[model samples]
Target chain A: MAERTNSKKHYRDNFTGWLLNIPYLAYTAVFFLIPLVWAVWLSTMDWNLMSPDRTFVGIRNFTGMFANPKIIAAFFNSFRYLAPIVVLCFLFGLLLALLISNLPDRIKGVTAVLFFIPYLTSGVATSVVIRFFFSYNSAFNHFLRERFDKDISWFQNPTSAFWIIIAIIVWKMSGYYALFLLSAIESIEPEVNEAAAIDGCVGFRRLVYITLPMILPTITTVIVLASGLAFGIYTEPYLLTGGGPNNATTTWLLEIYNTSFTNFRSGEGAAMAIANAVQIFVTIQLFTFVMNKLNRKFGV
Target chain B: MKRSSKIKTGILIAITAVLLVFSLFPLFYMVIQSLMPWDQVDKSMVLSHPTMKSYQYLLGSGNSSDAFMWVRSLLNSLIVSVPTAVVSVLVGLCVGYSVTKLHFRGKKIIYESLLFQMFFPGVILLVPRYILIKPLANHYLGMILPLCISTWAIFMYINYFTTLPNELFEAAKIDGLGEFGIILKIAMPMTKSVTTIVFLSMFMARWNELMWDMLVAPDIKMQTLNVLISTQFRTMGNFPGPMYAASVLLTLPIIIMFLCASKHFKEGISFMLK
Candidate 1:
């Protein structure tokens, strides 16, 4: 009986790890791995989401993504959203981080939450309020006209419409990003600041020369985040603009949705999605590669 | 030097205040817009004649089926979000403890893959995940399943689990309480920080879920609060006050939850990052 029990104990110990890991393995394989494979598979087919034409077309759908006009426009527009938002968010986020760092620690939490409220709030709702705020007939523009004799129709004009999107992104996101930057700033040893001060660093000059380089890694993370945010920006554009003003606000994801759902081109939509993933993967890798070199060069 | 430092302090305070107002203005405007009576919700937006008419309209005392969508969406959100949170946390805890504690084959591979998965943007999976799950669209489970796992959360829980004292595990072993019991009794109870972190972040992500929710639950009755509000913004563009009220309603629960649980969340989140 003792020998039988001993052998059973050995079997249980050996298999216990597998037993415990069963749930994660099963869930991840079914949900994540399988879906990933299915997406790639579906992208190669010409099926319009259901029934009849279930033919595989190799890379035709992939090539066709670039050929499509709306897809091309969306490709450029993602950059338009990505560049300005990333740049301005870094600037504003850094400033907010610096300012927040100066506040007494006791009240910092309250202030951070207040600022992060927008970030936490639904992007869809904020965009709705913003759309109303910038509406041509609203008091904001009316006041602008009354004060400066200028009544710019924000939504009707593509340039202004794009900027309004940028404003909404920066307003809602910068503070949240600033919290990450704040922690980075707080991590800097005070002695370094004193050392820089002794070497004549002060104010804006000090911030540019001394502080910016120190937080480059955190800034890299922020850039990655902001860019990811730009790509995933569906709610605001879909709800606020509906990719309107002559498709000026249409994004990659929006185009994909339009093609697959509205246009009944699921295969093409999946292809567009694959192409988007590749671009995001490449850019993120590039950011990481460049940031790593910069980190080394900047002696961090 | 003292004078210059004082000036710097003033400048910092000024900047902080300005940014605070800019950051907070939309939410403030939303509240004001929701409360302002229709008559005074004019071009100027001066709060001369404030009223709760919009909220009234929102609650559907106006008899226009307005409240039905909002209430239904909120309930749908609760149905989906609650399950997603509970499911993800349970999975995270199980996987985290198993990978950290038990001696398993392919353990290193599992750990590394989760790390690798973390680096990829979750949105990249959005399209594919949607396509695979599209048939089950409109069902609550369809929306919730795609968001049920987070590799990052798993790793976070693993990191937390590894930091736990090994003595408890040994004691549990000596007592012959078994691996599951050790994890359930000692490892789990002790890692409340990570639990709160995992639960809150998952809850928030699931709550604010829009993309998948939209794709999977586009049917009017199945839409989430966020999706419903977004659709409201699109369909009811003319009714700014009532829409703003809806926006406020959607945002208020999160704000209140954050306020109540923020002390826990701040530490939890910061630890996750570290």
Candidate 2:
């Protein structure tokens, strides 16, 4: 009787284990692994959206992408968009977090909720509002015209448009990032701050030398996240300017989309996508390595 | 002696005021534009007399075409978002439970891979996914399925699930409950807060998804709310009032949802970060 019961229990255990994992395995296999493999195969072929023919052209698409100046320019432009947003968002977010952390609990909660509003709203809606705000007869330009007699064509002029995008990116991200910082800051024991205060580390000095170092891991995570976000900045630029003023705001992803759908070069698009993937992978790996080294140096 | 402190407080307050204005001005402008009488908007005028004409056009009777399309897109968004949220959370729960509780081989590798996938920008997979799915499913199901199993959701689930005490599972196992039964009866009930957070985040992402819908469902009849908003912007050209009106209309549901979910959002981010 005992032996029969043991066998039945073991059989049930095995069956339940398999059943528990079945959905997950099926999902990852169908969605992630299959699409990933298909991307690899598609990258090696001369496939277009309309054409049924997919002639394999090993590594040529990658080489062509590398040789193209436009691709390189788009790559540089992505960096330009990324660097300012990441740095500005982090700095401003930390500052806001420090300010909010000092406030009363209810106010801090309310402020955090207010800041997170923009992050929750659709990026398309935000971009649309921004697009009009920068338009010639819009309120922003109207304000400029009335105040300074300066009617800058915000979208038409590349430099002005670039700065506007930078401003929008920073404004949209700072609040979201600030919430992360606030939570991280809140987790730091109050006694630590009190001890610092006892040690004559008050005001900005305390924030700079104590609080900042304490949240270094969270900061690293935020920076890594911001860098990842920078690479996928398609919808805002796409909606606001349609990669316009002569493709000045065309990002790497935008370029990929244009190459694949608009221009009917699926093979090249796949190659660009792979190139982008490799770039992001290497960038993230390098950042993680650097962060690990920094963590060791700081003994965090 | 205390004057400097007062001065610093004043400066901080001033700075905060400026930040608040900068952050909220675009939304304020959107509201103003939405309320402005369409005929009063002109090149010379920036702010015009407020009117309910735009809102009336959007929601009023006898304006069936615009209202109908808006309602259709809204329904479509709910359809995609609700299912995506439920499925993603359930799948994530199972995956997370396995990684946290089960002593399975290669679990570490799967966990790490899921983490990496979460941090990786999903744009790289967009083209390939479009190409692959265009032939197989070819509709809303195609887009929703690919998006439903987000790396973020899975990572969040794993992180939340790891924090759960393993004693509950052990007790259930001792009680002769199967693994699946333990998860269904014990694990899920214990992690309701985390489940709610996961659902909200996944739903928000799906609700706001535009790129995939645009890529997969080019038909206007099949478009999501985000796509509908984009289409309005593209076709409306320079008409700021109606555009703003439409934007405001589309944003209301999300704003309401966010207000309800803000607490969950905070808890979720804190839990994940921890």
Candidate 3:
């Protein structure tokens, strides 16, 4: 009787737990899991978004994506944006973080909030202002033409426009990543820093040797986070340049948007989105591998 | 030595000052541009002329249809955000409570599956999620439902719940409370701060959300603020000043929220960082 009662109680416990988990289960099924499966199925079909009849095309959508030059260029542009963004976000984020945290106590809180305010604001707002700042007749460019005899068309030229996107991303991301990495930086013991200083470790040398290796994990985190964010960069390219100058700034997400919604080719868009995702996954894994090796080599 | 250290501090402060300007210039420029006359935005003397005409126009001084659309979209944003915030937190709380505190079969599998959703590239589901939820596109359900489940918030709750002492739950159980009662009586009240962090995080993300909002809420009558602002920007050629005004209008509520509850906002970011 005792053993039977014990088993019954255990069964009741399991039931209670599952009952609580039902909401998440049902939600994930409807939104995430089901959609994920449906996304794969949709990729295999030929259908406009509005049509009920979807012909089973079976990988033609995937094959067709490879033939498109704009799609290919968008991928290349993503990497182009990703490379500079990764480097610049690390450089500026780390340096600014070090600078801000090292400030006098009273000023530190005020400055952190001020620096972080940009991160809190929506991407659309900032992109609009940036677009204006780089417009043809803006005062800054006009000043450049008048005084320095230097005027590069930001939006009109592909290379210059690409750099503008890179600059905006770096400007927005660096401070945000700085705050992200700050917690890790704070956890490092002050004694280690004091000992490093006693060993004549200061300035850039100290940062490169002592700080960089010690915070390798956080650095990895920052890089991964920045890179992942780079993949989903729709707001900037869409709002700022309209993926323009002959699709020079069009990213993976932008191309997918165009292929699916703009062209009403939902099947092909799904295929492209999947292909883009796989590439991003592979890229992130490679990045993580290299970082891990570096972390180990640095003896962190 | 003291003088040199002071100089070093001064230099650091100067660097900080420069960074602050770099960080805030877009915002400052937006504010300045919003005040400038519409025709002068791209002109040489951009800042010389300042007027509230852009703001007045956006505020519907003449009650223009375009301005009226913007006002409606702002309402649409609030409508989308409030429910999303509530749903995300509650669902996260449920999952967090189930996995961490409750005893169940396949609980580990459930936990892992929930987390696995995070790594799946969000890019892949854009089209499919749209199609599946497309029927609701004309309704608010399409706009809100698909965007509500945040793995970040879910995991944050799970991590937080682990830190709570088990004795409270055991004591509540001994007092003849059912699992739901215990969760409601103890877990819900105790996890107030975590709930705030999750709710605000979801709220902000949903509020600023554009891609899905644009996709689902395609009806011009029911677009969100971001969709409205960006659509205006794309279609309306050469009206940069009013666009700047709209951008300011879009960002102002978030800025106000940031000032009010920056702690919760930073906490949410830190949770993601972790």
Candidate 4:
């Protein structure tokens, strides 16, 4: 009788937990799981928004993406934007974190919050303001004209325009990433730093050797997250240039948008989406492998 | 050494000054341009005299074309955001609590699936999600429901819920509370901070959402602030003063939201970084 009662209680607990989870499970199935499955199925077919019929073409949709020149260019353009933004943001963020960590506590908190303000602003609204700043007759060009007696067309030139996007990204991301680095840095025990200081390790050398190695894990996390974010570079480029001037700033996501909505090529758009997904998955796997190797090599 | 310290302070001050100016200039420019007399603005003068003409125009002064559409867009944004936050958080809390406390078949698989959704780029879902929701077009349900289940929100809740001691639920169970009651009364209240974080994050994301909003609601009547800003920018040549004015107007809410939640926002970003 006692054993039977114990088993009954355990059964009741399990059932209660299962019952509580019903709402979330239902929601996940409806919104996320169902949609993900649909995405997979849609990838192999050509289906329009209002159409009832979807034609399956086997692996042709995935293979056909390579034949499109715009897709290839967009894939490359994505990296161009990604590399500079990720590297510069990480470097600048680390430097800022170190500077702030060395400051008094009250001042550090205030400055950290101040720096993070831009990251919280809507990217679309900020991009609008940036667009104006780079306009042909805008302040940047006017300042250039007055100072150097030259007119620089920022949006018209691919190289300059690309850098402008990078500037916008770094400006938006630096402070946010800095806050992360600051938290990780603050969590480090003070004794290690004090030991280094006693051994006459101060300034940049101390930071390069002592502080960096301790926070390598956080750095790796930031790099991975930033790289993942780079693949979905839509809002800034879309709002700033609308992938304009011969699609110079057109990243992969923008290309997907144009293909799906603008040109109404559903199959081609799905193909692009699938291709981008594969690339991202491969990139992340490669990044994880490299980071693991580096971590092991450094014993971090 | 003291002299060098003074020099260091001076350099710090200089850097701060430059950064502050760099940070505030674009916003100041947008605000000033919005206030400039339309005629003087076109003349390319720096620091032109301010006027309320642009604001008056956007608020439906003489010769305004469907200026009330901005108000409609704002309403649409709220409609989408409020529902998205409420439903997403509640669902996340339920799922989070279940995964942590419940012993069920395929629980690990379900948990991993949710995390997998987080790393997947949202843009890839555009065409497929559009097709999925196309069957229920022109309704508020169609716009809000598909965007409600964020993988990040669920993951955050799960992480938070796991940290909660299981003893709390066991005590509640001893008091004759059902599973749903424990989740509602005990689990939800204990996780308030994370809940707040989730709600604000979802709200902000939904409010400023662009790509999905553009894909799902192309109609002007259903556009959000981001889409409105985009449309205004795209047609700036036709209506420069009003575009700047609308940009300022649209950005004001987000700026206010940021200032209020700046602390939590930092924590949230740091959490993602980790």
Fnat per model, in the order given? 0.59, 0.46, 0.78, 0.44
Error of 3 at B21 (Å): 0.6
**What range of 10 consecutive residues in model 3 chain A has the weakest lDDT sum?**
A3-12
Clashing pairs in 2: none
Estimate, for each residue in B1-274, the C-alpha lDDT of model 1 and write its tens digit. Answer: 4997778777877877887887787788888888887755635556777889988876777747545767778788889888888888888887888777765567787787788777765544666677678789899889887788888688888888777776668788999897878878888787787878777778878888787788898899999988888766666777788888888888888788777888777777566645
The local distance difference test score of model 1 is: 0.79
Q: Tell me model 4's lDDT, rounded to 2 decimals.
A: 0.76
Model 2 regions more than 4 Å off: A1-13, B1-14, B41-49, B59-67, B119-121, B136-138, B175-181, B264-266
Q: Please give the ranking of all candidate structures by lDDT, highest first, separated by commas.
A: 3, 1, 2, 4
Worst 10 residues of 2 chain A by lDDT: A9-18
Regions more than 4 Å wrong, model 4 = A1-12, A51-54, B1-10, B40-48, B175-178, B262-274
How would you encode candidate 2's per-residue C-alpha lDDT over A1-300 as one tens digit per residue? Answer: 554666544334344444666776777777677778888888898988777778999999999987876688678887787788789989988888877776655567777777767776778778778887677776567778999999788888887777777887777788889888988889988999899999999888987778878888888888888888887788787887777676678788888988898898988998898888888788778878988788777634
Residue B80, candidate 3: C-alpha displacement in angstroms: 0.7
Give Cα-based local distance difference scores for all models: 0.79, 0.77, 0.82, 0.76
Candidate 1 positional error at A20, Å: 3.3
Q: Provide the DockQ value for model 4.
A: 0.49
Candidate 3 ranges beyond 4 A from true positions: A1-12, B42-50, B175-178, B263-274
How many pairs of residues in model 1 come into backbone collision?
1
lDDT for model 3 comes to 0.82
Higher-lDDT candidate of 3 and 4: 3
How do the residues B69-103 of candidate 3 rate in per-residue lDDT, one tens digit apiece? 76788889999999999998888888888888776
lDDT of 3 by residue, A1-300 (tens): 454657655445687788877877887888888878988998999999886787999989989877898899888887888898999999888988899878887887678778777776678887788777887688888888999999777888888888888888888778878876776676678998899899999888877888888888999989998999888888988987778889899898888998899999999999998899898999999999999999999945
Ranking by TM-score: 3, 1, 2, 4
Q: Which candidate do you rate higher for TM-score, 3 or 4?
A: 3
